[model samples]
Target: MQIRDLPYPDPGVPDARSGPRFLLWLGRNQLGGQLRSLAWGLLHFGSIAGLPYMVGVAVEAVLDRSGGRLALAGALIVLLGIAIALGDTMLHRTAVTNWITAAARVQQLLARKTAALGSALTRRVAAGEVVAVSTGDVEKIGWFVEALSRFAAAALTVVLVCVGLLVYQPALGVIVALGIPVLALAVLPLLPRATRRADHQREKAGRATELASDTVAGLRVLRGIGGEELFLDRYRTASQEVRTAAVRSARMWAVISAIQVLMPGLLLIAVVWQGVHLAREGRVTVGELVTVYSAIMILNYPLRHFEEIAMAYSFSRPSAKRAARVLSLQRTAESTVSRSRDGSERGEAMAPVMAQPPADDSLPPTGDLYDPATGLLAPAGRLTAVVCGDPDEAGRLAERLGGHPAFDDAVDMPSVRLGDIPLDDLPLAIARTAVLVQDKDPVLLSGTLRELLDVPASGAVNPEEALDAAQCSDVLDALTQASAGDDPMTAHLTERGRSLSGGQRQRLALARSLVTDPEALVLDEPTSAVDSHTEARIADGIRHLREGRTTVVLTSSPLLLDRAERVVFLADGEVAAVGAHRELVHTEPRYRAVVTRETDAERVVDRDTDFLTELDIEETA
Candidate 1:
C-alpha cells in the first residue's frame, strides 16, 4: 500500500496493544510482499542447508574409490555453491525493501500525529520525546518488525538441518538438536534487565536533548543576563549524566554479547566431542560424522538471530510506550451553540447580532474589554486604557483577557467568564477572525517585505496603506537600501527576521497584524521597542487608523496613553479607578504617581516647567 493510503491512528488515544499488533497487521495487510520476501528467505536458507549434505556426498564418493560418482559429487558441490550465492543476493534485496517500507509507515504515522496535535502538542509532550520518537524510535521499531520474518526462516532452516541429521546419523543428531536450543534460549533471561537499562538511557538522552533545545532558543536572553556560562555548566552536567546512563546500558549488552559468543563455542565443542566417540564405536561413518559437524556449525546462523531478536525487542518496547504517551493527550472540549432568543427567523438573525457582542466568551478581558470573571466589565466598543500599579497584576489581567486556559478558574467571580463559551467549540477559523492579539515580541517568519506583512487568514487591507498606518515607511526604505531595488519588496528575510533590527522586526509584525484588521485587537506593549519620536507617531496613527474598531493597547508609555479616550487605573489587577488621562491625573493619587513619576510638590514644579517650555518654544517659532 502507498504511504498515503495508510489510516492515521488517533494519537490522543493510541491503542496500548497496537504496537506489537501492528507487526501482525502489517504482515496481513501487505501479505503479497511479505510472502515474496519470505519465499526468498526460505530459498536462501535452503541452499545453505543443502551445501553440507552435498559435501558429505563428496566425502563418501572419495572414500568409496568410485571416480564417476566422485566427479558427479564435485559437480553437485559446484552447483550448490552457485545456488547459495544467487539466493543470498535475492534474500538481501527483498529484506531491505521490507525494512524501508516498515520505516516509512512509522514515519507517516508520526507526521500525521504531529499535524493532529498542533500547538497543544508542545504543551503536553516534551519536545525531546517527540524528536526521539520520530528519529530513533521509528527506526528501531522498523528493525524489530523486519527481523520477525528473517527469524522465522532461520528457525526453519535449523530445524530442517537437524531433521536431516537425525535420519542420517541418530546419535549425533540428538546432540545437535538438544544443544541448539540451550544456546539460543540462554540469553532470554538477561533480556528483561537489559531492556530496563536501555529504557532508562533513552529517557535521560531525551531530557538532555530538551535542555539543549531550550538553551539554544533562549541563548540571547541568557547571555544578556550574564547567565550563559551558568546554563552551559548545567547543560554540561546533564550531558555527563546521559553519558553515564549510556555506559550502563552498553555494559548490560556487553554481558549479553559475551554469553552469545561463549555459549555457541561451548555447544560446538560438545557436538565435536560426541561425534568423535560415536565414530570410534563405529555407530557412524566418517562421512556421516562430517555431515553432523557441518550441520552443527551451520546452527550458528539461527542462534545469532535469537540474540538479534532479543535486542530488537529490548529497544522497541519502551519506544512504543513513549509513542503511546504522546498519542494519549486529550484535546480541549468544543463550544456549544445556544438556542435563539425567539422561534422566528428574526430571532435567528438577532441571535448572531447579540452573539457578536461577545462572540468568544472564552477570550479574557483586555484593558477596556469586559470580563465576567471578576465582575468587572470594560464597556464594549470604546477605547479604554488600564493603569496598573503592579506589573504582575497587569500581566495576569492581560492573560485573562487573552482567554488562556490557565486563567479559567478566575472567571465569573466578579471577573469575566472566559469559559462560558467553549473555546474548542468555536470554529478556530472564525474565532481568530474576530480577536487578534499582538504580543510584545511577535515572531517574524523569513520572507520578502510584502510577504511578511500578509496576515495568516484574511487579506483585507492594502499592503502600502497598512504599512503607512503603522508608521513603517522608514522600514520600507531600509529594505530597499538593503536589496538595491533588484527586488526590494520581495527581498528574502533571514529566519526569525534576524537580518532586521529588533524595532524593525516589531514594526513589521505590527503591520502584519494591522492588515488582518480584526473586530477586536489586543496589543500588549506594541511600541516598546521603537524610539520616543517613532512611538508618538505610531500612537497618533493607531488612534486615527482604529477610530471605529475595538482596539486595546497594554502599555505603561504615557505617549500612547495620551491618545486614549478613557484610561482605567488598575491597582492590584482590579479596576481601582477609571477616567480620561487628564481626569485620572487629578483624581487618583497612585495613578498620578505612576504616570507622572512625581510627588505632589514635584508634580506642581514639573507642570510649571512644561508650561514655560511650551510657551518659550511657541515664542521662538
Candidate 2:
C-alpha cells in the first residue's frame, strides 16, 4: 500500500493470536510495500559491495602500469558514485514510505477498535495503555516492519562478499568465512538478558505513564481535595522506578554493543594477519591481499545489522502483543444488539463483531424498553423517572437500557424482549434508533455548538428546539461570552467542554441528545449539576417537549421527579415501588429517605419556628 492510500480501504482483520503472528500478518498484508523497500535496499547495498571490487582492480592496474586499465577504473568509480547517490536517495524514500504506511495501518485498526468499543475500551484496557499503544507502540511496530527489508538486503550482501573472498583466494577465504559466523553469533548469548531488561523497563514505563495520565485527568479534583502533592509524590516514585529500569536495560545493551564491536574488530585483525601470511608465501597477490582486507572491513557494515534487527525485534515484540490484545477485544454480546433474533449471523461475522455493520434489511423491534434485571419498564409514550438509593445502580440501569452490558451479571443472563425479540437479540439499529441513553457524566465533543448538536441521527429535530427544551440558554450565553463570534451556535468548545462549567456541559450534552429525537430517551441525572431553579425549568421543558414520547430519567431530584408522569422507585436493585412522585414519597419511607436528603439544620429551623409561633399565640391570649 502506498503511503497516500493509508488507512487502507480495509485494514482487514488482524491475526491477533500472538505478537509474532500479528507482525507476520502485517508483513503479509503489505507485501507490495515491503518488496518495494527491499528492491531499493538491494540497490543501495549492492553499490557498497561493488566499491571494494573496483578498488582491487584499480590497485592491479596501477601495479601493471596499464594506462588503459587505470582509465577504465576511473570511469567505473564515477558510475559507482552515481549509483551510490541514486540508490541511497531512493532507498531512504521507500523505507520512510514503508514506515508511514505500516504505522498508518496500525493507527486505522486502533481507531476503528476504539470507536467500536467506546467507553468500554477504557474499562477493558487502561486509558494510558490505549494511548501508548496507538502512539509510541505503533511507531515501534512500523519501525521493525520497515527494517526487515533492509536487514534482508544486508544479510544477502554478507553472503555475496564471503563468496567473492572464497573465489579470489582459498586460504584467506576460509579464514574470512569461518570468522564471519563467529561475529554474527557472538552477541546471541547476551540477547535474552537484554530482552528481559527491556521488558522490565517497558512495564515500569507503562505504569508511570498510566499514573501521569490519571493525575492530569483528575488534577482539578486532586486540587479540590488537597491531595495534589500526594499524587505528585506517587508519580515521582513511579517515574524513578521507570528510570531505574531503563538504566539497567541500557547497561545490558551497552555490553551487547561492546561485544558487537569487539568481535568484528577481532575478525578484521584475523583477515589482515592471514592475508599477509598468504602474500609472503606467494600464494596470494598483493592486490588480492588488499581485496581480502577491504572485503573484511566491508563485512562490518552488514554485521552491524545483526544487532539492529535484534533490537528492533525485541522492542516491537512486546508492542505488537499489546496492540494485538487491544485489537482482539470484542464487545460482549450483552453490550450490543445481537445479529438476529433467531441467533443467525447478520453480517460477515467478524471476530470483533461491532466492526461490521448490521444488515440493511434489519429493523428495530417495536415496544417500550424493559430491563429484566431491575423490572423497570419505560412505557411507550410517557415521561418516567427512576429513583434509587444507590446512584451507581441507577447508572447501570441507564446503561442497560441503552444496550451496554451489565457490570455484575453474566452476559448470558436471561432478558425480556419486545415483539418476540429479546433485548439481547434486538438489532443494533434498535439501540441506535429506538432509544438514546445519556449518561450522568455526558461528554460534549469538541466542536462548534452547532456541530456538537448535529451528530448523525435517524430523526430530524431542530437544534434550537432541543436546546431550549434542555434549558440551555445559560450554556449558549457562556459560549457567547467565551467566543468572538456573535452566534452562540458558532462558538467553539474546548475538548470535552473544558471551557464550560459542569452544569453547562451537562446542559449541552442533554441538548445534543434531545436533538436526536429517538423513540425513547434514557437520561441518568441529566440535571444533577444544575441548581434547583434551573432544574425545575428543565423538568418542565422536558415534559412539554417529550409530550408523547417515551422518556426515562433516572434521578432522585424532587424538582425532576415531581414532573414525571410516573416514578419507579428502586431498592436493592429491584423495582420496590411504582407510582407518581408525590404518591411514592408519602407511601415509601425508603424512597423518601433517598430523595429527601435535606440538611438537619433546615429541618431544625422549621421546628423552632413552629414553637415560637405557638408561644406568641399563648402570650397574646
Candidate 3:
C-alpha cells in the first residue's frame, strides 16, 4: 500500500501465536507490497551481479586487442550504470514503502486494541510496554519485514554469481564456492549469545522507559510529596542499567561484524592466490584471473546481507512477542459471556434497591448501570451516590461503569454489565452512548476550550448549559482574569490543563462530560478539589442538570450525598448499607465514620452549637 493510503480503516486482528509466527503473518498480509519490493530488489541486485561479468569480458577484449569488442564492452558498461541507478532508486522507494506500511498496520492494530480494551489495557500491559510496542517495536518489526525481500535478492545474486564462476573456471570456482558457505555459517554459533544480550538490553530499556513514563505522569504529585528527587535518582539508576546492557549487547554485535569482515577478506585472498597458481600452470588466462578476482570481490557485497538479515530477525523476534502479549489480553468477560450474565448470584448484587423516574423537563437517560462485582445498581432517571472508603476502588468502579470492566484472575468476580448487555461484547459506539465516567483526575487534553468540550456530534447539551451545570463560572472568571479579551470557549489550555488550578480542571472536565449527555454518568469525587460552598452549589447544579439522567456520584462529601436520592455505602468493596444520606449516617456506624470523619474538636463545636440552639428555643418560649 502507498503512504497516502496508510492508516487502514480496519487493521485486521493480528495473529498472536508466537513472535516468529506473527512476523510471518505480517509478511503474508502485505504480499503485494513485498512482491513489489522483491521485484525492485531483484533489479538492483541483478545489476550488481552482472557487473563482474561485464568487467571480465572487457578485460578479455582489451587483452585480445579487439577495438570493436572493447567498444561493445564500453556500451554495455554504460547501460549497466543506467540500470544500476534506476534499480537503486526504485528499490529504495519500494523497501521504504514496505517498511512504512508494515509499521502503520501494526500501529493501527495496537490503537484499535487499545480503544477496545480501554482502561483494562494498561492493567494487562505496562503503559511503557504499550508505548514501546507502538513506537520502537513497530519499527523493528517493519525493518525485519522489509529486509526479507532484500535478503532473498542477495541470496539469489550470490548463487547466480557462483554458478557463472563455476562454468567459466571450475578450479578457482571450487575454492570460492566452499569459502562462501564457511563465511555465511561462521557467525551462527555466536548469534545465540548476541541475541541473548540484545534481549537483555531490550528488557532493561523497556523497564527504564516505563519508569520514565510513570515518573513524568506523576511529576505533579511527586513534587507535592517532596519525592521528585527520589524518583529522579530511581530513573537515573534504571537508565544506567539500560545503558550498560546496551553496551554489552553492542559489543557482541561488534565482534560479529568484525568476524564478517575477516572471513570475507581471507576468502578473497584465497581466491586470488589460487587464481594466480592456475595462471602459472597455463590453466587460466590473465583475463580469467582478473574475472575470478572481481567476481569474488563482488560476492562479498551480497555476503554482508546474510549478517544483516540475522541481526534484523534477532531484534524483531522479541518485539513481535511483546506485541503479541499485548494483543492477546482478553478483557475478562467483555469478549465472551459476561460475568454478570453467567447465571450467578453476583448478578443479583447489581439489582437496584429502588427505581424512580426522573422529575424534570429533560428526557430520561437510557439504560441501567449495574456493577455486578459490588452489587451497586444505578437505576434509570435517578441520581445515586456511592460512598467508598477506598479511593482506588472508587476509581476502578467508575471505570467499570463506563464499560471498561476490571480484568482480574479471580473466578468469583462478577462481570460489569450495562443495560443487560455484556460490556466486552458491545460495540464502542453503543458503550459510549450508554455511559460517561468522569475520573477523580480526568485528563484535559491540549486544545481550545470549545474543542475540549466538543463530544462527537451531539446537540443535546450546549456549551453554556454544560458549563453552568458544572459550576464553571469561577473557571471562566479565572481564565478571563489570566488573559483579558479572550473568549473562555476559545482560550487554549496547556497539556493536562496544567495552566488551570486543580478545581478549575475538574470543573472543565465535568463540563466536557456533561456535553456528551450520555444515558448514564459516573462522576468519581467530582468536586473534591473545590471548597465546601462551591461543592454545595456544584452538587445542586449536578442534580438539576442531570435531573432526568442516570447519574452515579462516588463521593464521601455530605453535601453531594445529601443531594443524591439514594446513597450506597461500600465497605470492603461490597454494599454495606443503602439508604438516604441522613438515615445511613444515623443507623450505620461504619458509614458515618467514612462519610463524616469528624475529629474531637469538630464534635465539641457541634455540641456547643446544639446547646446554643436549645437556649435560643427556651428564650423564644
Candidate 4:
C-alpha cells in the first residue's frame, strides 16, 4: 500500500504472541515500505563504494596519459554522485513513512482495544502506563521497524564491497575482512546491562507520570487537605530516581559506542599503514594503494549501522512487550463485542464468531431484568427504587444489571437476564441498547453542546427535549454565554466539563443519557451532586421522561424514593424488604435506620424544635 493510502481500513488482527513475535508481525505487514527503503539504501551505499573504484581508474588513466579513459572515468564518477544524492533522499523519505504508518497502525489497534474494554482497561492497567505505551513506546517500536531496512542495506553493501576488494587485491582483502567482523561483534557483552538500565528508567518514569495524573485529577481535594506539597515532594523523588537511572543507562551505551568507534579506527589505521608500506616496496601501484585506503575510510560509515541496529532493537524490544501486554487483555465474553462491530474484519470477509447468527438477530430481548443473586426483579414498564445499606453494594448492582461487574468477572457470577434471555447470551451492543447504566460519576465528552448530547438512540428524544427534562436551562445559558452568544446547541465544552460545576456536569451527563432513551435505564445516585430541591425536580423529570419504560434508580434520598412505584430495601446485598417507600419506613426499622440515619439524640432535638415553634405560634395568637 502507498503512504497516502494509510491509516489502513483495518490495522489487522495483531499477533500478540510475544515481544519479538509482535515486532515480526509489524515488519511483515509493512514489507512493501521496508523493501522500497532497502532498495534505495542499496543504491546510495553502492554509489559510495563505487566512488573509490572510479577514483582509482581516473588515477591510472592520468598516469598512462590515456586522455579518453580519464574522461570516461570522470563522467562515470559524476553519474554515481547524482545517484548517491537521489538514493539517500528517497531512502530517508520512505523510511519516515514506514515509521509513521507503523505507529499509526499500532495506535488504531490500541484504540479499538480500549473502546472494547472501557473502564475495565484502567482497572487492569495503569492510566499512566497506557499513556506511556501510546506515546514513547509507540515511537520506539516504530523506530526499530524503520531501522531494519537501513541496517540490511548497509550490511549487504559491506559484503558486496568486500567481495569486490577480494577480487582486486587478496593481501589487503584478508586483513579488512578479519577486522570488520571484530568491529561488528565486539560490543555484544554490554547490551544486557544497557537494556536493564533502560527498563529501570522507564519504570521510574511511568510511576511518576501516574502519580502526577492522580494528583491533577484530585487537585481540588488535595488543595483542601493541604497535601499538594506532599505529592510534589514525592514526584521530585521519583524524578530524581529516573534521572539517575537514565544516566547509568547512558554510561553503559557510551562504553559500547566507544568500542564501536575504537575498533573501526584501529582497522583504518592498520589498512593505511599496510597500503603505504606496499606502495613503498613497489608491491602495488599508486592508484591501487589510493583505492584501498579510501575503501577503508568509506567502510567506516556503513559500520555504524551495526551499532544503530543494536541500539534501536534494545530500546524497542521492551516497548513492544508492553504494547503486547496491553493488547493481550481480553474482554470477558459477556462484555466482548464481535470484531465486525467495529469494521475491523470487514475487509477480510471473515466468518462470524458463532458461525451462525445469534438468536433474535442480535436484537435486545424484551422483558423485565432479573438478578437472581440479589433476588431483585425490576418489573417491566415501571420505576423501581433500590435502597442499599452500603453505597458500594449499590454501585456494583448498577454495573451488574447492565452485564458489567465493577470489580469482578460478570461471566463467573449469575448472569442477569432480560425476558428469559441471559444478557451474556446477547452481543454487547444489543445488551447495551437493552439496558443503559448511569453510575454515580458519569463523564461528559468535549464537543459542541449539540454534539455532546448527540448519541445513538431510539430517536424519540432530541437534544433540546432531553436538556429540558434534565432541567439544564441554566447549563445551556452558561454554555451559550461562554461561547459569546452563539447558539446554545453550538456552545462548546471542555473535557469532562471541567469549567462547569459538579451539579451542572451531572445534569449535562444525565441529559446525554436521556437522549439515548434506552429500553431499560439504570441510575446510581445520579442526583447526589445537586441540592434537595433540584434533586426533587430531577427525580420528577425522570419519572415523567421514563414513563412506560423500565427505570431503576438506586438511591436512598426521600425525594427520589418517595416517587418510586416500587422500593426494594437491600441489606447485606439482598432484598430485606419490598414495599412502598413510606410503608417500609414505618414497618421496617432497619430500612428506616439505613435511610434516615437519625440517632436518638437527633430525634429528640427535632421534637424540641417542633414544640418551641408551636408555643411561639400560640403566643402570637
TM-score of each: 0.73, 0.88, 0.91, 0.88
Tens digits of lDDT, candidate 1, 490-608: 87778998878888888888778788876666677788789999988888877776777667777778888888876767665455666678877777778888887778898778789
In model 3, the clashing pairs are: 334-424, 349-375
Worst 10 residues of 3 by lDDT: 338-347
Tens digits of lDDT, candidate 2, 1-621: 676666688889999999899999999987887888788778777778788878888899999998898889889978988887887788788878888888898999999887656566676799988888998899999999988888888888888888878887788888888888888888898899888888888888888889999999898899999999999999999999999999998999889889888987888888788778878889888788888888878778877888888998888998999999999886445434332221111221112111123345355555555665566666667899999878888866776777665534435434544423454565565656766789888887788988898876646668988899888887888778889668998999999889889998999898888888887789999998999999999999899888888899999999999999988888876677778889877677788778887456755776698799999999999
Of 2 and 3, the candidate ranking higher by TM-score: 3
lDDT of 2: 0.80
lDDT of 3 by residue, 114-178 (tens): 87777778887899999999999999999999899888888888888788888888998888878
C-alpha RMSD of candidate 3: 5.0
Name model 1 segments beyond 4 Å from true.
2-13, 16-40, 61-120, 155-169, 333-353, 356-421, 426-441, 447-456, 483-486, 515-525, 539-621
Measured with C-alpha atoms, the lDDT of residue 508 in candidate 2 is 87
Against the true structure, candidate 3 reaches a TM-score of 0.91
Q: Which ten residues in a row have the lowest lDDT in candidate 4?
A: 337-346
User: Could you arrange the candidates by lDDT from highest to lowest?
Assistant: 4, 3, 2, 1
* lDDT-best of 2 and 3: 3
Worst 10 residues of 2 by lDDT: 344-353
Which residue runs of candidate 3 sit more than 4 Å off their true CA positions? 334-365, 409-412, 598-621
User: In terms of lDDT, which candidate is strongest?
Assistant: 4
